[model samples]
Every structure is written in C-alpha cells, then in structure tokens.
Target: MSNFLLQLSYLIGSITFIVGLKQLSSPDSARKGNLVAAFGMVLAIIGTILFHEHDGNKIGNIPWILGAMALGTVVGWMMAMKVKMTAMPQMVSFFNGMGGACAAIISIVEFNSHPDGAPGYLLVVFLGLIIGTVSFSGSIIAYGKLDDKIKDISSKALTYFNLLLLLAIFVVLGIAVASPEVFGHDVVWLLLGLSAAYGVLFVMPIGGADMPVVISLLNSFTGMAAAFGGFLYNNPVMLTGGILVGSAGTILTVLMCNAMNRSLLNVIIGSFGGGGASGKGADGEQVVKEISVTDTAILCAYAGKVTIVPGYGLAVAQAQHICHDLEKKLEDKGVEVSFAIHPVAGRMPGHMNVLLAEADVPYPKLVEMEDANPGMSSTDVVIVVGANDVVNPAAENDPSSPIYGMPVLKVWEAKNVIVMKRSMRAGYAGIENELFFHPKTKMLFGDAKDTLGKLVAEIKEL
Candidate 1:
C-alpha cells in the first residue's frame, strides 16, 4: 500500500510538472506555473524520501538531512530577497553554474562508489561530467563578462588550443575508464581540470555581443547535465524535467543566434567584441557630429510620434523606472510613446522585457523589432538610451561590420535621433557608431538615469 501511494504521488508530481511548464509559456500564467512546479517538486521530494531504502535505516540520518534542508532553504530565501532585478542575469548564470557543478559532483561521487563500472553508467557519467564542467566554467565566464569585470576576449588561436586540450583530455579519460588500475585517479582529476579550462577557453573567445546566446547555451548544458545525472540514478522526474529544460533552452539559444544571423559555430569561433561603425567610409575620414539635450527635448516634445529604444546600458544604470517615468510624462503631453525592443537587447533573453515589465510599463507599448521597424521612418523622434551594438547603423550599411546583416531597431529612419551616452567609447563590440555622426542625432552625455530624469524635468519646464 505504501509503495503504491509513493508511485501515485510520483505520477501526480510528474503531471503537475508538465502543467507547470505549459503554464510558464506566458507571463500571465508564470506565477501559477511557478506554484505548480514548486508543489510538484515538494511531492517528488517527499515521495523520494519516503520510498528510499535508507529511510529510518542505519545509513540515513533524518536530522542531518533536515538540517541541510533548513540551511538550503535559508540560503535560497536570502538570494531571492536580496538579489536586485539588475543583478538577476549574473545571479541566474551563477545559479546555473552551481546546478551544473552539483550534477558534476554527483556523477563523480557515483562513479567512485561503483566497484566495477556499470555497463551503461560510463556514458551517463561522461555526459554529466562534460556538460556540467562546461556549463559551470562557461557560466562563470559569462558572469564576469556581464558584470564588466573582464573585457571581451576573442582569439581564434585560443579556440584551436582549447579544442586540442579537450581532445587530449577525452583520450586520457577513455584510457583511464578502460584501465583504472594503471592510470590511477590522477587521470580523472587531470581530466576535470582540463574540462574546466576548456570551458573558460570556450567562452573567452566569444565576445560580449553574443552573451545572451552563451547564457542560453550554458543553461541548456546545465539542464542536460542534470538529466544525465538523473539517468545514471534512474530517477524519472529528474530525467523528464532535465530533458524538457534542456530542449527548451537549446531551442531558445538557437533562436537567439538566428535573430542575430549567427550560426552556432560562428558564435563559438568568431570574436564579436568589437561593435561600432563597420567598414571604411567612402572617404576614409572619421565623422564627428554632436548635438545638445535641449534640442533633443524640443524635437521630442513637438513630435507627433516617438519611440524609445532601451538596452543593457539602461539596465546598468538602473534607469528603467526613470525611463518609464519619462515615457509617462511624454504621454501626458500628448507625445506618442513606445519602446523598440531588440530581441537581444540586454545580457540575456527577454532581459529588456523583464526590466520594462518590472517598471510597470504597458505590454502594448513594448514592441519587437520586426513590428516596430516599419513604423520608424514615420516616427518624429527615436531616443536611444545606453545602447550600443544593437542600434549601430553599420549593421545595415557596412558589410564588414561585425553586426552587419543582423536586423536592428532602424532608429535611424526617424526624423530626429536622441542618443544618451556616457562617452565616445565604443560598445562591447569595440566599434564606433555611425548613427552618432548622423546630422539628425543629438547626443545627451550623462548617466542614463540622471539624464532621463533631467530631461523629464526640463520638458515639464518647457
């Protein structure tokens, strides 16, 4: 009867998980999805604890497990409560790395416990090891890049070296798995180190311009690693959940890459850190044009229609609220206000959307590039905030620009352009923006939040 109940509970949990995933498809259902998933996870955990052979046995200490659970609960709560919205991307990356690290550790522990290699377990272990190791290191590198602690590093020669190192490590791992006696555990440790190095090398060459895709790919790897670990342990729930997450994440990653017209190999091999004006101008001479904030405000206030394009810089400045505030003020004055959101605008997928949503911006006002581009030419003003690579006109005009061929917000088509920037420094892709030199563009130099707020005040005075 107890065994039957456990099985039933497990089945219910599985169903709940499925429903939760489906619910998560839309923002309206996301909260319910989270609740359902949490409930399912609870059920799964309870069922596992009750049905496990170690329950009330000499090997299992209930108190120890309970204590560990309590500690984990507190840590999770703190992270949830303390992490800011602006920091969520890096936090997500770190958590994903930790999850992958957990899966990797589990695989290593399980392998060491087996006296004779389980016939099919080696593949599962290898899968976990590779995926977890890669995810962990890649995520860390991503965190560093997103946080601006390390500048973008791109080198093809480095990629080649990483590939060679990975191959050598795998070969050693294969030999050690076949003959554990002669090679000793040192080979396993060496492989682990090399696997970590490979992860770093893998992400290092990829520029910050492609970070959102990298984050998605790393998330997929973490999910796959968890699934592999589940397979090794014959846990149906982990297998199902992991596979679902892995597949979904991979699809999202691919879509993001496609949105940028970047192939998986290109993302991995091409150093995309330099984003600016691509290619030589016809005369091979630099163009420098500047405008004032007062002129920009006048154009915006008098315009029949206007659009605001927000990017990572807006988030970095914690300026979403100010931006929203500015938008509201514009609307009150009868200026049309809308947001042009590029698919890869921020550090992660949907990052810009999430930030805007957090600021309580209306969903209707937020428009994707495809839907917004055609309307740009009719726009009276387009205000770009702390955005660089995404708005670089070179994407359309310069064949040699790193971002060429990738669709952008088309802000250049507007009657007047207002760009809020800190300096003349190029974006992560390290290229100059041709849009800055356009006759219609007015540069507002300051912190995004401060600049937008001041503009709001200045407009009211006008």
Candidate 2:
C-alpha cells in the first residue's frame, strides 16, 4: 500500500512538471507554474522518504536527509532572494553546478557499492560520473565568466587542445568501461580528474557573448547526467524530472543558437567575441552627435512612435522600473511606446524581457527582434538604454567583425536614434558601435537609471 501511494505521488509530480513547463511558455503564468512544480517536487520528496523500501526494510537516514534538505532550502531561498538582476546568469550557473555535483556524487557512491556490477550498470555509472563532473566544472567556469571574474583565453591552439582533450576523455571512458578490472578503483578517480579538466578547458576559450548558449548547454549536460542517475536507480520521478530538464535545456540552447545566427559547432570552436578586434571606426577619429535630457524628452514626448531598446547596462543600473516610467510618460503624451528585445540581449536569454516584466510592462508591448525590425523605419524615435552590440551596425556592414553574421536590432533604421550610455566605451563584445557615428544617432550620456528618471520627470513637466 505504501509503495502504491509512492507511485501515485510520482505520477502526480510528473504531471505537475509537465503542466508547469507548459505554463512557463508565457510570462503571465510563469510564477504560478513555478509554484505548482515546486509543490509537486516537495510532495515527491516526502513520499519517497516515507515509503521507499529496499527488500523488507524502509529507507533509513531520515534525520540526516531532512537536515540536509532544510539546509539546502534555506541556502537556496536566501540566495534567490538576495541575487540582483544583473547577477542572475551567474547565480543560475552556480546553482546548476550544484545540481551536477550532486548527481556526480550519487554516481560515485553507487559505483563504490556495486563495483562488481554488470557491464550495463557500470556503463551507466561511468557516464553519469563523466557528464556530471564535466557539467559541474564547466558551469563554474561559465559562472566566473558571466560575473566578469574570468577572462576568455581564446586561441587557435587552445581550441585544438580542447578537441584533443575531449577525445582523450572518451578514450579513457571506453577503456575504463571495457576493462574495469584492469585499473581497479583508481580508474574512477582518473576519469573524474580528466572530465573536470576537459570541462574547465572547454569553457575557458568561449567568449563572453556566447555565455547564454554555454549556460544552456551546461544545464542540458546536468540534466543528462541526472537522467543517467535515474536510470541507475530505476526511479520514475527522478527519470521524468531529469528528462524534462534535459530536453527543455537542449531545446532552449538550440533556440538561442538560432537567435544568434550561429551554429552549435561554431559556438563551440569559433571562440568569438574575445574583444581584440577593433570596430569600423575605433581610431578615435569618428564624430558622434550628442543630445541633452530635455531634447530627449521633447523628442520622445512629441514623437508619433517611440521604441526602447534595453541591454546589459540597463540591468547593471537596475533601471527597468524607471525605464518603464519613461515609457508610460511618453505614452501619456500620445506617443506609442514599445520595447525592442533582442533574443541574446543582456547576459542571458529573455533577460530584457524578464527585467521589463518585473516593471509591470505589458507583454504585448515587448516586441521581439523579428517583429520590431519591420517597424524600425516607421518609428519616430528609437531610445537605446544601456544597449550596445544588439544595436550596432557592424553585424550587417562589416564582414571582418566577429559578430558580423549575428542578427542585431535595426534601431539604426529609425528616423532618430537616441543612445543612452555612460561613455564611448565598447560593449561586452569588446567592439565599438558603428551606430554611434551614424547621422541619425545621438548619444545621451548618463547612468541608465538616472537618465531614464530624468526623462520621466522632463516628460511629465511637458
């Protein structure tokens, strides 16, 4: 009867996971979906602890399990509450690495207990170890890169070396699985070290701009590793959850790659955006126009249509609310306001969307790149807030540019473009923006939050 109830709980948990994932497709239902999924997970955990039995005895270590759960819950809740919008990507990478580490540890414990297990069982253990260890290490590196603590070490030689290292990992895996008796227990540690090394080197060369894709890929790796653990333990709930996470991560990664106009292969080996290449006019001789706060407000308030483009700097300044206020003010003046969102904008996928959503911006007003591009020519004014590479013209004009083929917002096509930035410094891609020198573009220099607040105040007085 207990086993029956546990299976029922797993079934309910899996159903909630599916429903929650579906609801996550839209922002309006995302919070509810998250809560529902979390509740289901908690239910599954409780059911497993109470009912799971091996042979004739129930699972032990209840006190330790509950204690660990309580600690993790407190730590995770605190982190989630304390994390800033700009550090969200790093936070995600760090948390995902923890999941990977947990899966790897599970494999290690299982392998030690079943050293003389069948070849199929040993294969699952080895695979879980390799994938989980790699995911953990790679995710840590990605976290460092996103947080600006690590620099990209891009080199042609490094790329080749990474490839060789990957090949060696696979070779070692094959040998260990085919002949576990030969190397004994030491082989597991050796494999762990090699996987960890490969993980670090794999992410070391990937540039900053490609971090969204890397994060998604590593998340998928963690999912895959978790799924292998499920297979090892024959746990339906674990398997379902792992598969859902893995497949969702994979799909999201593919979408991100497509949005960037780059193939997965290119993202892995190209080492794009290492920050060395100069822009079309990086010689400090190009002239740029500047506009004042009053002029910016006057222009936005009087324009028939205005579009705001947000990027990483907006997040850094925590200006989404003020920007929304500016939008509302412009709208009140009979100007149609909308936001142009690039898929790869900011630090992660949907970052700009999330930022704006937090400010209570309506979903309909946040236009995607494809939809927003067609209307750029008709837009009376384009306000770029803390955005750089997404609006740069080099993607379309310069063949030698590292981000040349990647799609960017066509804010330059608008009638008048006002770029809100702190200085003439380059963007995260480490390249100058050609749009700054365009005839229609004028720079509005200040911190995004302060400038947007000023714009809101100015528009209200008018």
Candidate 3:
C-alpha cells in the first residue's frame, strides 16, 4: 500500500512540475509557477521519506534528512534575501553548482556500493559522474568570472590543450564503460580529478561577453547530470524535472548564441572575445560631444516618441527603477515611451526585463530589438541609459570588429542619441562604440542613477 501511494505521489509531483513550468512562460504567472513547483517538491520529499521501500525494506532515518533539508532551506532563503540584483548571475551559478555536486556525489556513492553492475548501468553512472563534475567545476569558474575574481585567459595553445584534454577524457570514459571491473577504485577518483580540471579549462578561456551563453550551457550540463541520477534511482519526478531543465537550458543557450551572432561550436572552441583592446577610432582618437542634463531634459520632455535602451551598466548602478521613473515622467508629458531590451542585455537572458519588471514597469513598454529597430528613425529622442555594447553601431557598420555580426539596437537611426556613460572606456567586447562619435550623439557623463536623477529633476522643472 505504501509503495502504491508513493508511486501515486510521484505522478502528482510530475504533473505539478509540468504545470508549474508552463506557468513560468509568462512573467505574470512566474511567481505562482515557482510556488507550485516548490510545493510539489516538498510533497515529493515527504512521500519519499514516509513511504519509500527498497529491497523489501522500508527506508528509515527521519532526523538526519529533515535537519539537512532545514539547513539548506535556511541557507537558501538567506542568500536569496541578501543577494544584490547585480550579483544574481553569480548566485545562480553558485546554486547550479550545488545541484551538480549533489548529482555527482550520488553517482559516486552508488558506484562505490554497486561496482559490479551491468554494462549499461555502469555507463549511466559514468556519464553522471563526468557531467556532474564538469558542471560543478564549470559553474564555479563561471561564478568567479561573473564576480571579476578570475580574468579571461585565452590562447591558441590553450585551445589545443583543451581539445587534447577532452579527447583523453572520452578515451577514459570508453575504457570504464567497456570494462567496469578491470580498473581499481583509484581510477574513478582519477576520472573525477580530470573532469573537474577540464571544466575549469573549458570556462577559463571564454570571455565575459559570452558568459550568458556559457551559464546556460553549464546549466544544461547540470540538468543532464541530474537526469542520469534519476536514471540510476528510477525516480519519475527527478527524471521529468531533469529533462525539462536540460531541454530548456539547451534551447536558451542556442538562442543566446544566435543573439550574439556566434556559433555554439565556435564558442566551445574558445577562440573569441579575448583579443587585445579593441580599436577606439579609425585613427585612435575621436571628439566626444557632451550634453547638459538641462538640455537633454528639454529634448526628452518635448519629443514625440522616446525609447530607452538599458544594458549591464544599468544593472551595476541598480538604476532600473529610476529608468522606469524617467519613463513615467516622460509619458506624462505626452511622449510615447518604450524600453528597448536586447536579448543578451546585462549578463543573462531576460536580465533587463527582470530588472525593469521589479520597478513595476508595464509589460507593453518593453520592446525587443527587432521590433524597436523599425520605429527608431521616427522616434525623436533615444536615451541610452547605462548601456554600451548592445547599442554599439559597430555591429552594423564595422565588419572587422569583434561584435561586428551581432545585432544591436538601432538608436543611431534616431534624430538625436543621448548616451549615458561613465567614461570613454570600451564595452565588454572591448570595442569602441562608433555611435558615440556620431554627429547627433551626445554623451551624458556620470553614474547612471545620478545622471538619470539629474535628468529627472531637470525635466520636472521644465
């Protein structure tokens, strides 16, 4: 009876997971979706503890399980509440690494207890071990990169070395799969070391510009590792969740690669985005045009249509709320305001949208690149707030540039462009924004929040 009840519980959890994931498709329902899924997970945990039976022996141990879960819950809750919006990506990498570690440890323990397994089962365990270790180490490296703790390192030699290491890893995998009993226990430990090292090597050479894609790909790796765990344990909910995450992460990764105009194979090859400083101008110099907040305020207050483009700089300044405030202020004066959001804006997919949504900005105002480009010329004022690479005109004009083929906002098409920037420094791709030197472009120099505040105050006086 308990076995039957547990199976039924797993079924219910699986259905809830599917429904919850569907709800996550829309921003309005995302919170509810997360809560629903979390509830399903809680149910699964309780059912497993109370009713699970294996080898005709009921599973035991209540205190240890609840204690571990309580600790994790407390830690996770504190981190969620305390982590800054700017550090969200690092936090995501950290949490994803934890999931990968759990999967790897599960596989390791299972393998140690049941080394004499069927060839196919042994293959599943081996795959879980490799992918989980890779995900764990890769996620750590990604967090380091996102947090600026590790610098991008790339070279032709390093690229070749990585390829050789991958080849060696696959060779070892083949041996273990073919003959699981032939190798000593030490061989599995060696496999773990090699995979962990390879994960570091894999992410070390990827540039900051490619971090969103890398994070998505590593997430897929973690999902696949978890799926192997599900296979080992015959857990329906685990399998379903793993499949869902793996597929979603993979699709998101591909979309991110497309947004950046880079191929997945090329990204894995790790030869891009680590070159020397990008050229500033045709002859290494250009005149920078400045505009006063007062004058910029007048222009925005009177424009027929205005579009705001946001980037990582906005995130760093934690100024999305003020940007929304600026938008509302403009809209009240009869200007049609919209936000142009690049797919790869900030450090991850939907980053700009998430930030702006927190400010309670209406969904209709967030415009995508393709949709905003056509209407840009007719727009009167283009206020680029704390953005750099996504709006760089180099993407459209300079074929030799690193970000040449990437799609960028068509702010340059507007009558006048107001670029809010900290300095003349290049963007993440290390290329100078050709739009900055355009005749109609005016640079607003200062911190994004401070500059936007000034603009808001100036506009109010008008």
Candidate 4:
C-alpha cells in the first residue's frame, strides 16, 4: 500500500509539473505556475523519503539529505530575497550549476557503489558523469560572465581547440565504456576531470551575447543528467521531472537561436557575437539630436501612441517600475502606451517581459516584436530606455554587420524616438546604434531610473 501511494504521489507531482509548465507561457499565470511546480517538487521529495527503497536499503542517509536540503533552501531563499533584478541571470546560472553538481555527484556515488556493473549500466553512469560535469562547469563560467567577473573571449584558435578537446573526451568515453574492467575506478575520475575542463573551454570562447543560449543549453544538459539518475534508480518522479526540464530547455534554446537568426552548430563553433561592436557608427558618421526632459515629457503627454522599448539598460538601472510609472502618467492624458519587446532583448529570452511584469505592467500592454513593428509607423513616440542593440537599426540596414540578419525591434520606424542611457557606449554586441544618429532620434543622457522619475515629475508639472 505504501509503495502504491508513493507511485501515486509521483504521478500527481508529474501532472502538476506539466500543468505548471504550461501556465508559465503567459505572464499572468507565471507566478502561480512556479508555485505549483515547487509544491509538486516538495511532494516528490516527501514521498521519496517515506517510501523509496532499493534492495530494502531505503536511502539510509536521511540526516545528511535533510540537512543539505535545508541548507540549500535557506541559501536560495536569502539570495532570492536580496538579489537585484539586474543580477537575475547570474542567480539563475548559480542555481542551475548547483543542480548540475548534484546530478554529477549522484553519478559519482552510483559508479563507486557498483564497482562491477553491467556494461549498459556503466555506459549510463558515464553519460551522466560527463554531461553533468560539463553543465556544472559551463554554468559557473556563464555565471561569471553575466556577473561581469569574466570577459567574453573567442578566437579561431580557441574555437578549434575546444572542438578537438570535445572529440578527445568522447574518444576517452568510448574507450572507457567499452572496457570498464580495465579502466577501473580511476577512469571515472579521469573522465570527470576532462568533462569539467571541456565545459570551461566550451563556454570561455562563447561571447556574452550568446550567454542566453549557453544558459539554456546547460539547463538541458543538467536535465539529461538527472534523467540518467532517474533511470539508474528507477524513480518515476525523477525521470518525469528530468524529461520535462530537458525538453523545455531545449525548446527554449532553439527559439532563442531562431530569434537571433543563428544556428546551434554555429553557436557551438564560436562564430557568433559575444563582443560588442566597437566604433562601428551607423552609416559611418553620427549626427545626434539631444532632447530635454521637459520637451520629451510634453511630446509624450500629447502623443496619441507611445511605445516603450526596454533593453539591458533598463534592468541595469533597475528602472522598470519607474518606466511603468511614466507609462501610467502618459495614459492619464489619454495616450496609448505599450511595450515593444524583442525576443532576445536584455540578457535572456523573456527578460524584458519578466522585468515589466514585476513592475505591474499589464500583459496586454506588452507587444511582441513582430506585432509591434507594423504599427511603429503610427506610433508618435518611442521611449527607448537604456537599449542599444535591439534598437540599433544595424540589423536591418547594415549588411556588413555581424548581427545583420537578426530580427530587431523597429523603434526607428516611429516618428519620434527618445533614447535614454548613461553614456555613448556600444551595445552588448559592441556595435554603435545607427538609430541614435537618425534624423528623428533624440538622446536623453542620464541614469534610466533617475531620468524616468524626473520625466514622470515633468509630465505631472505639465
């Protein structure tokens, strides 16, 4: 009866995971969906502790497991409560790396426990070890980059070196798996080291702009490793959770790659953008037009339609809430305000949406790139708050640019554009925004949060 109950709990947890995942598709239901999935995970953990058994051993290490879980929970909660919005990507990478490390540790313990396993079992263990280690190391590197602790570096030689290193790891894996008896315990350690090294090499050559894709790919790797653990232990909940995470992460990675007009192979080969476009001014020369907050506020107050385009700068300035405040003030005067969100905006997919939703922006007011572009011509004002690459105009106009084919927000199509930023620095892709020099564009130089707050005050005074 207890065994049956455990299986039943696992089923319920799996269903919740699926339902919660589906709910995350919309911003309105996302928070609720996350809670539901977390609840399901809690259920799984409890059911496993009470009922899981293998050869009647029953995971006899409850004290350690409980203590570790508690510690991790406390750490996670503290970080979530204290972390700034700009550091979200870094936090994600940290948590994902922890998950990968856990999976890799499982593989290590299992392989050691079963010194003389079946050939197929050995293969599975090796697979988990390699993939999990890679995810763990690569995720750490990604976290460093997102936190600005590491520079994005890529070269033809480095790319080729990574490819060779990957090949070597696979070769060693094949040899070890084929002759487990001869390879013995040391082979696993050797593989683990090689896998970890490859992970660092793989991510180090990837540019910062490609970090989003790397995050998703590493997530998929962790999921796959966990699935292998499930297979090893014959745990249904573990298998289901792993499969869900793996599949979802892979799908998201593909969507991000497609949005950037790049292929997975090319990304892996380190042929994509990671460094910003330096000194590549739009049309070889720039003629900037500056706008004061007073004038800008007046323009927005009277405009029929105003579309806001947010980027990494918005997050950096922690300005989403005030931007929303600005939007509300504009709407009071009967202006139509909507957000134009490029899929690849900010550092990750759905980044802008998440930021805006946090600021209580209505879901309907968030316009996707494709839908926002067609109506841009009619938009009287486009407020670009701390965005550079998405509104750069290089993607559409410069065939010689690295990001030439990527789809971008058409903020330039609007009649008037107000770009707010701290300075005249290149975007994440290291390219100068041609839109900045466009005849109709106006620069508003200042901190985004400060400027938006001032703009809100100015609009009220008007």
Which candidate number maximizes lDDT? 2
TM-score list, all predictions:
0.94, 0.96, 0.96, 0.94
lDDT, residue 346, model 1: 79
The order by descending lDDT is: 2, 3, 4, 1
How well is each residue in 1-462 modelled by candidate 4, as lDDT tens digits?
A: 778878988998998899899898876798899999989989888998888777766767899989988998898999988988778888999889988888888889988898678878888888888999999999999999888899878777887888888898888888777887666788889989999999998988776457799999999999999899889888888898898999999998998899988898878884556443433643465578899999999999999999999999999999999989999999999999999998888889889988998999998999999999999999999999988887777788778677778898888889999999898877776666778888989999999999999999999998
- Quote the positional error of residue 171 for candidate 1 in Å: 1.9
> How many clashes show up per model?
9, 0, 0, 6
- The TM-score, computed over Cα atoms with residue i paired to residue i, of candidate 1 is 0.94
- What TM-score would you give candidate 2 relative to the actual structure? 0.96
lDDT per residue for candidate 3 within 1-462, as digits (tens), equals 898889888888888889898999887898899989888888887889988888987776778888898999999999989998888999999999999888888889988998877878878888899999999999999999888899888888888998899888888888887876566566578788889999999999987568899899999989899889889989998898888889989998999999989898878895566666564455756787999999999999999999999999999899998998899889889899999999988888888988998889999999999999999999899988778888887787778677888898889999999999888887766667788889999999999999999999888888
Quote the lDDT for 224 in model 2: 91
**Tens digit per residue, CA lDDT, model 1, 1-462:** 666666677777778878998999887999999899999989987877777543444326778878978998899889978988988888898888888888888878877776357536665786688779889988998888777786666555787787798788778767666766766655546667878888888888777568888888999999899899879867778887888889989998999989998897788766685233446445546555666666667777888898999988999899999899989888888999999999988787688999999999999999999999999999999999988889988899888887888888889899988888888787776776888888878788889998888888877777
**Candidate 4 lDDT trough over 10 residues, lowest sum:** 274-283
- In angstroms, how far off is 272's CA in candidate 4? 3.2
- As a whole number from 0 to 100, the lDDT of residue 457 in candidate 3 is 88
The order by descending TM-score is: 3, 2, 4, 1
lDDT of each: 0.82, 0.89, 0.87, 0.87
Of 1 and 4, the candidate ahead on lDDT is 4
